[model samples]
Each structure stands twice: as structure tokens, then as C-alpha cells.
Target: MRKIWLTGIAALAMASCTSKTSTPQPTASALAALPTTDWKSFRDTFIEDWFKVSPADAVYQGRHDFDGGLGDWSPAGLKRQGDFLRNAIAKAKTFDAAKLGKQDAFERDYLVTVAAGKLFWLEDADFPHRNPAWYVNAGLDPNVYIARKYADAPTRMRAMVSFLRKIPTAAAQIRANLKTPMPLSYVNFGVAAFNGFGDYYTGDAKKAFADVKSPALQEEFDKAAVAASKAMHDLGAWLEGQRGSATQDFALGADKFSRMIKETERVDVPLATLEAAGQADMKRNQLALVAACAQFAPGASVPACMAKMNANKPANNDPVAEARKQIPELRAFVLKSDVVTIPDQEQALVEESPPYNRQNSAYIDPPGPFEKGIPSVYYISPPDPSWSKVEQAGFIPGKSDLLFTSVHEVMPGHFLQFRHANASPSLFGRLFVGYAFAEGWAHYAEEMMWEAGLHAGDPETHIGQLSNALLRDCRYLSAIGLHAHGMTQEQSRKMFVEQCYQDEGNAKQQSARGTYDPAYLNYTMGKLMIRKLRTDWTATHGGRAGWKAFHDQFLSFGGPPIPLVRKAMLGGDGKAVF
Candidate 1:
């Protein structure tokens, strides 16, 4: 699961220069002072400037100076964000590469790449107008105040009140910005998320901060919460009303989809080539699943075989409890296997997902790099109660399947990757983790754990890991097919069931997810690139013996696009990132 703070459209390196107007420009003096010796200070200032516009990001990064703030989401605000990125990109390109050292040059490229990625979404894609998820995930989230223990209860409560008070305006801005006749799946997502926020504000959010002892604050919180809840519910109702005109126009088309990969992930492979890679991986995982099924459930079909594994659901069907038990063992295994360095002893807590943010089955909410001693939270979402009992049951992961998920979200996956990221020397790298790099590493860790002898020779465990791989493979193809090849959601869902062997419920969820999250293909793409890099790097760096060193070095770059890391690692153009 992605971090709450980092999961939104606007969360990806929001802005570089602070811009008060729609068309911000670098000062002539600023541009004239080019190629200065203080690259580090410039980078640091960029981050500080970014926080002024994207305060929520700062709050999550453990910078309390911007604790109660949210990004401006009005039309003017959106234009300023885009303008800021454009100005920042221009300034970044002005620095002389020859004057900057190799590391500084690399950092310059990294910042430019980040700013470009953000620009693509803000200006090129026009997500703020076309996608409600941009607002829902970016501005509407209050998880930081509720979950992180960065401050005392009273302080956090105060921040929460400040946040809630702003939501009425944020809600209006979101409703105004989202043009109508949206994709059906997108409309539903917006409806559910907005309504969920309404429910959460008056329920869990209120309770979480109940211990704060101040009548004045309590009165303020109550008034703010009521308005916020009403605003959310009204927004949800408005989105639901859009169901009458909802269309199936969710595709980014081939061109923008193609650019999405290059700009955001730094991957320039042809879409057909990318599709072929996913298809080949799908076949590989399918064959492995067949062999594993033969061993685990003789004479049964693939679906039945998966059902058998999934039948052994978590104890009491409580994934949160099961996840807790799994993590300690997973941590111990990673240590014993010596696959990667843990960097620190910080542990992650397992929790049930909050109602407003249960879009993903599970995700790890790690503390930002600037934070210290704060535990990460691994949240597992229970099935929606509206579903039929069987569908709900199908939503719960089987014990073996949950184990690999544990491996993905905690242990040697997101949790450990973040621990290494927190130790990074480069602040830019620590702050601007690319989507593909983060998800890809977590997904790759699942397979790596299995290869490292996690439940070695156990067919069920192997099936568990392969289940996830096949799911990602299907996502890779589904994203391409849905967005670029004119595939319908039903077609994608059926493919998930028949080819990926997903349950009906999961297939539905995964298929719908592709429309909104086209770049989700990164799970497989990132894993493949990382695996290829490992083979090439380990060939000379002690082969299999270099696993820990490779992991440590790879993570040291924080979370740049994998290609950038590949170049840094292999010391060439790194054009062969595949």
C-alpha cells in the first residue's frame, strides 16, 4: 500500500518554486545567479518552498510548521502549482552540469525529472478537472493527524480542527473543479470516498481526538467537524448524482499513456513491447501456478486450487491480528536470510483500515524520512459490508496469501525499504520517491523473499507468492488494454478471473482500479527491471553473495526512478533499464 500522504495525484513533488500567481516566474537575479557552488542549499530551499504550497506533505514529513494546512485547490491555486513546476524546471535546467559534481549533476537531473512528472499530471493530464481522485487523495485526507504520533494528543487535535475547518472550502473547490460526465468507475470512487469521509469525520475522527481536554477546542472541533461532514456528504451526493451521465471515457489514450511512463517512471519502452513483457511474465507465472497447483491440489483446476489455499483464511478471519503475528516472523526471516539490510530496528504496527481509505486491500503507512522513532502502520481493509456474504468472504485473503502480503507491506517490503530511505544522505531522494520505484520495490520484495527460501519447497507458499505476481502481471496488461487498447472493464475483470485466477470480488476491484490507476503496471515493470539489474550487478559484485550489498546500495538513492538508480549502479547511460 502507498503512504496516505504520498498516494494522491498532487502528492508527487507538488511544486518547486513558491508561486502566488497563476504565472510564476523566476526572478532575473535568481536566474542570473546560475551555477552557484551551493547546490545543496538550493535543493533544500526547493523543498521548503514546496512545503509552503503543499503543507500536508510537510506535516506528514514531520515538519509541524505546516501542520494544519492543505494545498490550495481553486483554479488559480492549480495554475500556480503548474506554473511553479514550469519555473522550477527552467531554473533546474539553467545550472551548468560541468560546474556541478557528478553527484550534484545526478541530483539536478533527479529534481528536473520530478518536476516534469508533476507537471505532466498537473498541466498535461488535467487530472484536477478530470479525476476526482486528485482531490480525494490529495487534499481531503486527514490520516496524518489521526494516525501519526508526531505530537501530543492536544496538539494533533488542534491540527485536526484546523484541517476540518478548511474542508468546506476544499469540498467546494473539488466539486467545482471536477467537470461532469466522468467515467462511471471514477464517479463511484468519488462518491464512496466522499461519503466515507463524511462517516469518518463524525465517527472515528471525533473519537480519536476525544481525549483532548479543552472546552473551547472541543466546541471549535464540533462546529468544524459538523460543517466538514456536511460538506463531504453533499459532495458525495453531488458525485452520486453524476451517475446519470457517467460515461466509460477513462482511457488516457495511447499518447498520454505512453508519456506517463516516460515522464513519471523514466521508462521509454514502446507500449507494445511493454505489453509483450507483461504477457511473457504472465505466461511464466501461469505455468508456475499450474505446477504448484498440481503439487498442492491434484486433479483440481487452478481456481479450485487457489480456493483451497484461500480457504485457510486468517485465524478468526481477522487479517489485522494475523498480520501482527506474521510480521515478527517475517522480520526474523529477512534477518536470517540476509537478503537485505534492515538499517534500523523500527517496527510497524498492524491495524484495520479506516472507512474513508479502504481502496486498497492493504498498505503500509511509513513515517516520512524526516521523522524519527515513529512506527509505520500496516493497514488491512476488511471487505465492504454491502457485499454478499460469499463476496465478502472472498475478499479476505487466505493465510498463505496474506503471508506474502505481509512480506510486501512490512518485513522486507515497504517497511524495510522506507527504513533504508530514511537513512539516505540526499534529502531530495528521501522526499521525492517516484511511484514506480516505490511500488516496484515492494512488489519485487515478494518474489525475492520466496527466492530467498521463505517457506522454500512449500507449494502453497510458492502459490501464494505467484498469486500476487500473476495479479500484477494481469494489472500490467489490464492497464495497457483498458487505457490504450480499448478494453472494457468487464473484459479486464474476466481476464483477471480466467487468466490471473482472481476471485470474482478481487477481479472486480482490480479491474476498476486500472481505469484510475493506469500506472499500477509498475508493480511488474519495476520488479522486472530490479531483477534484471540484480543479475547484471551481482555478476561482478559477488554474485549471489552481494544481495545485501546490492539492496543497501540500491535503496541508498532513496526513490528515484529505477533507471536513474540503474545508471548510478551500473555506471553507463543506463538506457538498458529493462
Candidate 2:
């Protein structure tokens, strides 16, 4: 139930000099310098202020100088951060995009969206004070210092100790800031995760950093960790008490939800349009699934067919190892098929996800765009041993499912797309990676690889790809349904089982996820956006044969909202996104 937030200006302090041509320029665009240089002054003051409010994120992003400090959740501190965002947004308006180059204009647009997104969260939604989940997700991880190896063991251990020391203050702020009569789902999530994290901090997390040999540092860590664990335990105890009294009133509502979509993603489409699109995708994938099921086994029930497919899962049911086995081959497929360029020389290392980071079964942990020469992590969390046998079975995906996930996480998906991003001359390209663009390209890459004959269009391969597609489709429907249409968790869970063919365990997990992460809908929504953009851009540029050309062009801009990317790619933004 973590909120998706990245609160910083695009790239203000890094670039000090704007590039200008000496020769006679074609127009104002040719004469115009990269606005990044001019905007550099804003980033310096902004980032310093930002780090003060969100030090853990700064350290997580490899800004080790901001090490050891926890975020300020007190009223005065919150107001200071809010005012900082307002001023940054106001300053961003002064950049005259009319005289700037195409790249500069795009950068300007992106920076505005980033500012607007931050403002929307702080002022509009006011999530910090309202949502209790923020308190948990924000301070829930004292183990990040152990998780990331940006520095040596001793240094990281010290940072961990400092973070641990700050936990009591952070927990006190959480107690003070949270409003009562909390949403049942949010309270339940906080109770489970916060309590579970307290256990992790006391045991597994301590084990992770136990290798640091300095006895003095160890003594400091022991004391700090004890205090941090108690803080979490106390926070969890309070939340557990509230859970019984919590009610189901978690929707972002229509206006704020609509504004959320617009300000964060630049998708101005109506809710009905989004729901209709999702329903259509669900039906489309269902038909494809039916056909694939038919091809796999003639006239079998969907469940029976799925059971047969599920039984074809990994030998030991270890997706992490299976992912490691398949990724090199997936890369070979990319080169053979020539779908998109693979600029990533480094491969994503597969491993178990950290204890604090195991909300989903699997995820790719990419380095921040400013980070280079660092290996990307593709973390696969196995089913908790506490789960029942049937539940554990549901956690294990079929081999083909793992293959598509590998394609999405590595090779020509996130990892490869990011390599092109890092190569971008625009700092905006590197820094301002949007959720829509990143998830869209990764999602699009799944089907694109299949279209390029990943398994020669085999039926099982189709089943795997379509199953993932349907899951995303269900997410799209459930997001709209739960938030905009008043759909209950039970109803959303039923939709997953009925339409997406998800297992009981997965259905519950996904349904509960939509309660907190409405933006999970972006998987299908973003994939479709990329598909439409590709079809339109490729038609005029070259036809289907220009797949690689379209992909290279699309990924070259790094991650901006699809609308801005569309405006850049198509020469103008239109009313109809699709």
C-alpha cells in the first residue's frame, strides 16, 4: 500500500552551462539553449531543501551525503516542503518555451508535470496527513542501508544506525499526523506490514548487516535497532487497535482522481473512456486466452486448462532461477529478432527481494538514472513459508510466464530501455523517468517480443503472454471500478478470477492492491498507449517493418508522460489519445 512519490525538481543544479550554436541558427529553437542550464539554479536550492524533508530517499538514490536523516513529518516541516514545491512550480513558469528548442520545450513540459505531480500530492490530495499508509511506507524500512550497497559496510552500517535512531521520532510523527476513523484496508495493511517489519528489523535485517565487524558500531546499531523495533511495534499496536474500528472509505473520489490522472500522467481521458478501454482489453484477452486454451487442449474448461498449464511450471518451482536461466536467451532473441537495441552491457542480477520490499511476488529494482555502472536487481520473492500449499502453488508462475516477465524486466524491456535513457543528452531523459513511460515500454515490450516470434507464436507462449495481459486488464478495470465506480474488494476479486483467470490467492492480492495502488491500472493502459503511438508513428515513418526504428525512437527520450512523448513524436498532441 505504498504511495508512488518522487518529490524533486527535474534537473536544476547539475547542468551549469547551456549549449549555444556559433553558426547562424535556423530559428529561435536553433538559437535557444537547453533550459536545464538556466534552470540549474532552481535545482540546487530545491534539492537541498528536498533532502532535508526526504533524506532516506536521497540516500536510496545514491546521494550518500544525505545519509542517516529521516523525513520530517512535523507540521512546520511539512509546511516548509509544501511552500518549497509552490515556489518551484512558480519559478518553473518563468521559462519561455516558445524560444526554446524541441528538446528544451519537452524538458520544460516534463519539469512542470513533475512539479505539478508533487503539488497535487502535497496540497491537493494532502496524502501525508490523511493516509496512515504513508506513515508506514515512509518509515517502514530501516533496512534500506543493508539492502543497497552504494557505500562500504561500515559507512552503510552507520547510516543504518542513524536511521534506526530516528525511528522513534518518525513513529511519534506518524502517531500525531494520522487522522482517525481510518480506511479499513489502509489500517489493516499498516497493522500487518508495520508489525511484520518490526519482526524483520529485529531479526532478518540485523542478520543482513551482521557482517560489519566494528564492535563499537555494532553496539550502536544494537541500541538503535532496539529502539527502532519498539517504535514500529508501538506504531503497529496502535494501528491494530484501530483496524477493528476502520471503515471502507478509501476512494480518492472523482475530481481528485481525475486530477490525479491528468496532473501525474497527462492522460486527460474521461473515466468512462478508461473503463471502456479496459473492458474491451479484458474481452479481447479473454478471447485470445480461450483460443490459446483451445489450441493447448481441445474443449477443456478454463480452470482445467490452466491447471494443466500450471502443472507445467518450473521443475522446482523457483522463478528466480528460471529467470536467470532465460534472460541471456531472451537477449539472444532480441538480437536475432532485432526488436529494439540492447544498449545495456550489464545483465540484471536475480535474487530474493528484501524482507521490507516484498509486497509483490516479483519486481525489478533499477538504479536511479543518475546511477551508472551499477547492476540492476530483478528481485523475485518466493511465497512466504507461512502460506498454505495451495497458496504457494498459486505463487509459482509457469515457465512461459517467467519468460515474459524476464522480457519485461530485462533484455529489451526496463533494463534495456534504461540504457538508452542513460545515453540521452537531455538530463530530463536521465532524471525524470515517468511511471507511464517506464511501465508502458516494459509492458509493450512483452507483446512486441511475442510478435517478433519469441516462441514462434506457440500456444503456451500465447497463454503466458495473454494471462499477464489479462492480469493487467483486470487491474485497469478494478482501478476504475474501485475508485470511480464504487466497486467492492469482493467484486474486484471476482472480476480477476472470472475475467483474468487468476488464482484465488492472486485474485485477493491484486484486488487488495487496487484499494491502495489505483495506478496499477497503468500496466494495460500504458501498454495500449504505446501500441497506439507505435502504430501511428510507424505508419507515416515506415510500416510494421520499422518496429526497431519506432522502438529506438520511443525509448531514446527516456521516460516522460506519454502525452508529452506523443507531442514530441507526432508533432502535436491531439484530443484522442488512442
Candidate 2 at 315: error in angstroms? 2.0
Model 1 ranges with Cα > 4 A deviation = 4-37
TM-score of 2: 0.91
Tell me how many clashing residue pairs each candidate has. 1, 1
RMSD values, in order shown: 3.8, 6.8
> Which ten residues in a row are the worst by lDDT in model 2?
16-25
lDDT score at residue 447, model 2, on the 0-100 scale: 86
lDDT of 1 at 495: 97
Kindly list the per-residue Cα lDDT of model 2 for residues 1-578, writing each as its tens digit: 01223322233233211111111112222212223346554444445555455555555455555566667778876766667666666776777778766676677677778768767776687777667556554545654466556667777777777777777887888888878888777776677677777777778877877888889988988898888889888998998888778887778887778888788888998888877887888898888889889999789988777767767788788888889999989989999988788775777888877655565667776655554455777878777676789988987888987788888878787778777887777776766677777777888888888888988979888888887788888988888888888899899999988878887777877888788766677778778889998999988877888999999988888777888877888876533375
What TM-score does candidate 1 reach?
Answer: 0.95
Find the candidate with the highest TM-score and give its number. Answer: 1
Candidate 1, 1-578: lDDT as tens digits = 67542232222232221111121222333333323347876676666566666676766666665666888888877876777677777888878978998888889888888878878877787889998777765657788778887767777787788788788988999999998899999998898899999989989989998888898988988998999999999999999999999999999999999998888778998888888889999999999999999999999999999999999998899999999999999999988999888887788999998887777789888777666567889999999888889989998999889999999899888888878776787766777777777788999999989988998779999999999999999999999999899999999999999999988888988999899888889889899899999999999999999989999899998888888889888988856356
Best by lDDT: 1
Any residue pairs clashing in model 1, and if so which?
1-363
Q: CA lDDT, every prediction?
A: 0.82, 0.73
